[model samples]
Target: MDAFSNVDSNNRGKRIIDGYTPEPYHMPWIGLLVKDGKARCTAFLVSKNANAKASVWVLSAKHCFNDVLFDEYEDKTINSTSYGLLFGVHDLRFSTQHVIYRTIDELFIYPDEGLKTKDIILIKLDRQIKFNSYINGLCLPDSTEEHTPYEDTPW
Candidate 1:
């Protein structure tokens, strides 16, 4: 049997909050530090493999790459590595061991009109990662609905 066979099928409430550690395979919660010298925001370092190949892509918000001015500049030049995702962050200092996945190609942004959500950014990894690690893949939502509403809400 496959390890993912019995994995959680529900996508809505399947979010996992992991403890920060020095482990390499562990998924570290990340934040973006602006280039003009600003603070960071709440973000997470996610990995995904759209293709079955060994290559993995890191996902984050496009705005996390730089300020909104770059969006108006028409020039696609932006600083990607300016922000660092500190692993095992307890009190701001880099406490736990963390691996900073380098950005291979230009960031890919998902274009959508009506949605106010942040644009999804993709950063390709230099090499392929193992099947099992702290950076595990997550299951996306399918066509099925499995969530229930509160008792007071109308069915």
Candidate 2:
């Protein structure tokens, strides 16, 4: 058993009930998806660009783009230029030298009507990311875990 052994069981794959802000770089894969300079949703780096040293692909929630709060964009085609990802920063309110913002080059969403249980979207950055201590990709799940039950899995 470790310090988080109890937390791990209680949380059941979710963050702490009342979580405190994590230190910078503690969760390097985390990202902030934004549109026109405002926050849209939270995202995470899933893989690195094949030809680049850092990650360029991120995963986010599909509802971020479909929510009634963002209805202004539902009728208009989503312009990649208007969206971006902010990586390597913990606090957006403060200016940070470690932050890196990348414009979105493309968005891949599974066309699910009514946006049911399939709530994921993949975003490609316009340029290759440069990895630092504060930015990196999360390890991808292996094929063996494909059939594992969600409740028993660790993200």
Candidate 3:
């Protein structure tokens, strides 16, 4: 039973995530950080830069590369150039034909940043990512949806 019971599914209302994977290539902008050919963390393609052009900018949680297990590099530092991201893939255990791995040329994070607080970082791919049906950049939200009207988010 939903408030929009009267409303049909055709009328998309503030869509909610139900752990449902969208149609393949529907979210081709998403990528997984690959460590030794294994997926570790998640990353998403954003911005169109001249260097890498189509989705050159990769945004990910800074804590993903943290040295300490329990702490966010409170005692150590994060190896920015250690890991690489694998795009055009849905699963790591099984390799797909479109899986493309790109090394991390560099990573950017605040000097005094902490994991408990803001734990996000941006990475630059060693090479440009070719945009395809299963690999592309996502459009950064403009000023249209400023604030999420709902409170509970499962992202």
lDDT top scorer: 2
Model 3 regions lying over 4 Å from their true place: 1-18, 49-53, 68-82, 143-145, 149-155
lDDT of 3 by residue, 1-155 (tens): 11111212232234455545456666777887745333456788776542344656788887777653434445333353455677786543445678777777666775554688778878887777878778888666667768666333112
User: Model 1: runs farther than 4 Å from truth?
Assistant: 1-39, 42-55, 66-77, 84-91, 112-115, 126-133, 145-155
- Ranking of predictions according to TM-score: 2, 3, 1
lDDT of 2: 0.65
RMSD of 1: 12.2
Clashes of 2: 0
User: Runs in model 2 with CA error above 4 Å?
Assistant: 1-16, 48-52, 67-77, 146-155
Error of 1 at 46 (Å): 4.4
Error of 3 at 10 (Å): 37
lDDT of 1 by residue, 1-155 (tens): 12122222232232235522333433333422223223333334453433332334455556565444545635443454453332223333223333233323345566654236756666554445333333344333355957656211000
Q: Which one is best on TM-score?
A: 2
> Which one wins by lDDT: 1 or 2?
2
Candidate models: Cα lDDT each: 0.38, 0.65, 0.61
Error of 2 at 88 (Å): 0.8
